[model samples]
Target: MKKPKKPKRPMLAFAVTEIDDHTGGIVWARTKKAARIKGAARWGYDEPAYVTCRREPWADRFHSKPLPVWVMVANGWHFDCLGCGIRIDEDLPNWQDRCGADDTFRDMLREARRYRKWTPQCVIGHQHSDVFCSQDCKDADDAYRAACKRKEAHAISVFQAKVLKRFPGVTLVTDRDRMHPHAYATSRKRGIVVQQVSVEFEFPGMRYGPASLRWDSPFSSSYRKVEKPYFSCCNGDRAAFEAYAAATRRAAQEPTDRDHP
Candidate 1:
């Protein structure tokens, strides 16, 4: 009779419970007790060590596996296939082999292996490889930015409206291109078109003077006249506009008194 063949030794697996400097590792073992013994030898006294087994993948697609395996808990590594919810060895040979379904799977696996992070999601909750989930998300973000710009423009318009309401003779000077809001007032008696006192709404806090404001004008001579003096007010300060109107009226009256004298 042929000599009896010795039974093949079962494949052994060991999970890294702890390593030097709070790292993790894996080892093959002949038995569960032996695996634990090896882990203790490497990690020192009272460190965690375990005998783990590998499991087959549930499905063969990247999209099917939305969550990631290979997690770190208290400086210890844990391995589980998120798709199948099965315990796996640290090397993850079974899971990695199953991920070779398609190019997308390979790419996703590469990213997961490289960064050890899952796919990113947008603020609105769609997941993607990039910042946004799709073109629609990008468009929505763009629309949000545009709405903010329009709101700022509306604020400037509302401020201009308040100024015009307070000073009846003033009109927004559309003919002159400006970085900030600009308006002019025509003196009914003097027939002189002088720029009304307006604040620079662009930045650096609204202040008085034509130099404080910026504008584009083909006829630079038009704005050559000194800006009518008025009490400076903080931007969007309605009470300040009221005071400015009163001061301007007083200034106009004083000039007229001098002229008549």
Candidate 2:
């Protein structure tokens, strides 16, 4: 969990400004422990919000000790794409390129954050960010997943129609929340695969409504087919997918073709 960086505050006399506890004003140092405070004085604070470093005028008195680097420098921040694993130490704003900045970790530092805004497609790559290096990395991980909703919906319409057409009396059962969603299709309440929901078909005395399934392939999952049912984000309906392999194993089936007799 990354915390938001607070806005830069001005220093009064510069002893590593920190929030004062007693006076509810700026304390001189990151913290007593972190800043290694040597000496300090009292304060005159009013209603104190969160422990924030307060800004004060120029110091009319003198301090005994000096402070260390408690602030972020122009080249202090660093980042690696959690998705692509690229040490984004330079500027990269293009989403189409294989590796480039998308402003995920823009500026905790300084120069490279801005100048590179004009300089796209850096020869060597190394940008600064907190977590993900690029926006593409985030999307690849589906950070903002609109999901394969259209595909799932299409499967539902097509498969439901297919099942109903084959047997009018047979009923089709569906529950979006039959299973939990995974990286491919998430939400325990939503039986989704990648972006589509699982489905099922039932006979006159069979179960209808809620069902779950997953069909795995490199194209759909966009990678290796995982054996774990839940881990499989295979695109397509799950209605009877789990039963497919077993059914095939039990019966040696072949495509039948009519010959001209």
Candidate 3:
């Protein structure tokens, strides 16, 4: 007998509700539960764990808030063709750090795996992963809290530079408010350490640009085959990006009746 289809629930993450494009169904992650687990995983214990989903290619707009939330689904270490399965930490007795924090990350992962249409990769917080800024910290002392905030921001900048080098032709944009006076003073007062040299201001053909250039055509256009959607514009090794551009140009040059007439 065919199993009955389960009713679609709104996918929610970072306290934001998810809306499915195909089914037009709305999904919001159980944020309170997920956040509780996530916080517990990261700050509340010796080691933290939680389950989350890889944000699909284009699921950012519907969020009432800004883009790039930290909540994600974590499938354990195993993979079953589609992608990696739930992390091995889920059921093991000493799974949290013993299994790399997969157990604590398991709550939402179980649900995502049942669907089998998506995958997971761990996303640390904004400072660690370049997502967002969060003031939520266990340290209640004002000075300590201020210092941590600066640390978080500094971590983000270091990671940002690393990402830029890893992805060529990638463009990144950050808000001005991110550099507000309070942010700078806090960093100075706290004595933030510079880990890596900042990304070069200019690299040949790799100037900062709009985010649109990151995604390639999912389908073949009249002109050429497009590339897949990439996380950042800086993707593609030297050879790959060049080859793609050459092919696109060649396709564009093809003689067309419309052009000649």
Best by TM-score: 2
How well is each residue in 1-261 modelled by candidate 2, as lDDT tens digits?
999999764323322222554222223443333222322232222322323333222321222332111111112323444655654533344323432464343332333442334322221222222345444445655643454554445645644554444344444655447533222444334433443333455443223332323333333534545332221113342434334433444443221221000
Better of 1 and 3 by lDDT: 1
Write model 1 residue lDDT over 68-154, tens digit each, in one string: 222221123333332233333333333455454565866766545643432222112211122232234457556655655554455
- Runs of candidate 2 with Cα error greater than 4 angstroms are 1-85, 89-115, 118-131, 134-147, 180-198, 207-261
Q: Candidate 1, residue 122: CA error in Å?
A: 14
Q: So what's the TM-score on candidate 1?
A: 0.24
What TM-score should be assigned to candidate 3? 0.19
Error of 1 at 118 (Å): 13
Clashes of each: 1, 25, 31
RMSD of each: 23.2, 16.4, 21.7
TM-score of each: 0.24, 0.30, 0.19
Instruction: Put down candidate 3 lDDT per residue, 99-160, tens digits, no spaces.
Output: 34444457545444543332122322321233211122112234555665665466445445
Model 3 Cα shift for residue 97 (angstroms): 40
lDDT of each: 0.39, 0.36, 0.34
